[model samples]
Target: MTQHSDVVVIGGGQSGLAAGYHLRRLGIEHVILDAQAAPGGAWQHTWDSLQLFSPAAYSSLPGRFMPAQEGEVYPDAAHVVSYLADYEKRYELPVQRGAWVSAVHRDGPYLRVETSSGDWRARAVVSATGTWTRPFLPAVPGRRDFTGRQLHTVQYRSPAEFTGQRVIVVGGGNSGAQIAADLTGTAELTWVTQRLPRYLADDIDGRALFDAATARRRALDVGRTDTGGVASLGDIVAVPPVRAARDAGLLCAKPMFTRLTATGVEWADGARAEADVVIWCTGFRPALAPFAALRLRGARGHIATDGTRAVDEPRLHLLGYGDWTGPASATLIGIGRPARDAARQIRDLLG
Candidate 1:
């Protein structure tokens, strides 16, 4: 039997849960479908040592706030997972875990969402699958010829596993910096990037970044084109650990290498460096494979959207697709406004 819902949220991560929080307030009938076996979404898969760039007071979902743990200024990934699970329980949002969404296609007047467990027809759909699953690695000549282990950040668990081995961490983003810092005690680490990494001042964190972005976005929303673009939140935030690393001179990085040789990477100058492992912190693309049947993604592999609303499919909304959906929508604190707006639109449509 095909189940039907007023709205079906196709992810149980930060964005989907935030949307569910709004839909509940609107008294909409909806269910969140999570592909993960548990409630944490992508947080469950992050590296064990991962910590939020912001303090707990600054990073939270809607309806309730993430409480700061004793002695922990910044919550680690496990803490976040625990909080997400607790939030779901506290709100009683109807979520179907282990429901891997396979595809979503137009079905007459509704969107038919096919999943591993079954199918659902929904009046409105919010796609928030996020980017963790689609890790990206830059192309390099002789990449395949390298016999050394190469993995994206998503596959990394702990630095202990690579203790004392030569490791190359690639990318200038926060993830690369943080992971490289984590490896300092365990690995013979080398940081490689296309360019020099940018570090936000020690006083700034994810909270300030999100706030600045919100202001800039709201200015643009009001038809003022003078909103100076906010700095990228990807810049390394000087959290305690990252700060210590920088002060200790362990956070240094090198420019990108030219290619991957059998033993390791070679620089543009033809200098070869030996490495046992390469951790590519290159980043991720949104995981919206379930919407492939709609063929809405453009040449850039991203869907055109009027804010969070799909431009080609009015009944479909794309959240957590990053800034294209909403300013800082990919972050915990930045997703709430867009979620509320999306839920309101769904309510108006259904009514």
Candidate 2:
């Protein structure tokens, strides 16, 4: 049987939960569908030692603030998972877990959401299925020919398996820095980047990043000078472990290698390092496969949107992808604004 809802949120992560919270507040009936068997969304898949740049109090959804973890300043992945599960229960958000969304297509006046559990026809659909599932490994030359083990950031858990091995981590972002740091004293670690890694000031954390992003957005909105939000600051934040690693000179990064040999990688200047493992801390693209039937994405490989609402298809909204959707829509703290706007737009459209 085909079910119905006022809105169908196609993810139950921070963005989806935020949408549900706002919709409930506005008395709008909606349902959140999640592919994951439980809550936490992509956070559940993060490495074991990963910690947020911000404290628990600063990382929260719309209605409720995340409580401080008992002994930690920055909460770990498990703490975040527990918080999300509790939030879902506390708000009584209608979330159907393990309901993997296959596709969403236009159905006359409504949108038909095809999922493994069932089909739902909704007045509006919010596609918040974030970027974790689509881990991006760049097309480095000889990447396929390399005989050593290779893995992306999503597959990494801890450094226990990498002991006594020569490992090279690629990417200048926080993930690479953190993972490199995690391997300290364990693996013969080598960090590589396209350019020299830039670190934000020790005082700068996610709170500062959020504020800067908000300021930059507001400035751009009024046609003022573009204040480079987080971009101007640096690429990586010095979270505790990362900071310690950098201070100890363990985060020194080498220029990106030109190609991979059977056993290792060779740099541009003919310096080669033998490696047993290579970890690509690259990144992810949005999981927009469910929206493929709509043919909404542009040449940049993302859907054009005006404040979370799809420009061409007004009934669809893309949330939590990144700044393209909203200023800081991908972060737990930044998602509320966009999610609220999406809910409001849906209410207005359905009314």
Question: Which one wins on lDDT?
Answer: 2
Whole-model lDDT per candidate: 0.89, 0.92
Per the 3 Å backbone cut-off, how many clashing residue pairs does candidate 2 have? 0
**lDDT tens string, model 1, 226-285?**
455446544678778878988999878888998998999999888878999999999898
Error of 2 at 281 (Å): 0.7
lDDT of 2 by residue, 122-217 (tens): 999999999999999999999998999999999999999999999999999989989999999899999999889999999888999888888898
- Residue ranges of candidate 1 with Cα displaced over 4 Å: 222-234
TM-score leader: 2
lDDT (Cα) of model 2 = 0.92
Clashing residue pairs for model 2? none
